[model samples]
Target: MRTVGNDLVRSQLHENRKWYLGLGALLVVFGIVLLAALPFATLTVIYIFGALMMLGGIIHFIAAFKIFEGGYRWFWALFGVLYLIAGYYAFSTPVKTAIVLTNILAIILIIAGVIRIFNALLFRAFQGWGWTLFSGILTLVTGVIILMSPDAPFWVLGLFLAVDILFQGVNYLTLASYIRREVPKSSAEQ
Candidate 1:
């Protein structure tokens, strides 16, 4: 198993660099487009949420029949019932869900920032660690700002989302580009 894993890794290590670079470019472009359409994007998110609720309800109703046929009727029936209830709640309180989702995003960003800061600190023992520290500090600041302003309107949330996506997209692009340049020149080259 270990040998198989090693072989897989070795094969991947020799794969063409253009694939990673292309993916990175796509991410960057997506981020830019999302940032550019922040206002419309918020509405799109709300619509998607509503659609998901309707779909969930339909799926649950279908599952109820399947569960009855399977003879473990009570357990799956309970799941279907709960799902229906959640679907109703989603349909009735979509605005509330949107607000909660925004808050969740803030919390997630804060957690991610804190983790990155910790990782940067841990990696500081290694050489050439300044860039990591800088990135960590930037992320921490962004997270703190978002968390402190959790009551921000949809526009503000959209703006934050745009910035976050753009930053991450640029980060990934830079990493991919570096890998593309470094890999062919290194010993891992096939």
Candidate 2:
């Protein structure tokens, strides 16, 4: 049983250290570039989203044919058409789509914040519960600010995407370094 937490995984990561390093470097570069060109990155994200929606629509259309149930087939077909329409709309009016998506994100964040706060409060005895409560409050405030801001939609998603990618890149780099350091020690011990 070579679980990810074990030495086998560490050995594999050591073996693939170069790949992780390269990917981390690439993502870090991309994140920095996106952060530099925030507006362009925002539009790029919308375009990518539109393309994904179009792909999803096509998949749904194919699925409709594969589904033998009449109601399911019709439902898939209907949703496929809707997805295609939405994709087209996104492509034609990306800025509007971004704004709409950002607004939705705000709503989702608010909901998540409330849920986190409720969980933290309900599980007061849990270790680090106060941190969870603090995080929830911050999330709630952020969501409120984003929702209220007229200019938030123009850059919020792009900023979030850039930051997420940047962090992921750093995480990859850290994992690679850790594996590189520890694997040699483990090998020597064995």
Best by lDDT: 2
Tens digit per residue, CA lDDT, model 2, 1-190: 4443466655666768999999999999999998997877888888888998899899999999886478999899888999898899889999899999999999988998999899999999989999999999989889999999998878888898899899899988987887777565334235
lDDT of each: 0.64, 0.86
For model 1, residues 121-150, the per-residue Cα lDDT tens digits are: 888888867777777677777667765774
Index of the highest-TM-score prediction: 2
Give candidate 1's TM-score: 0.50
Deviation from native of the Cα of residue 18 in model 1, angstroms? 22
The C-alpha TM-scores of every prediction are 0.50, 0.86
- Name model 2 segments beyond 4 Å from true: 1-12, 185-190
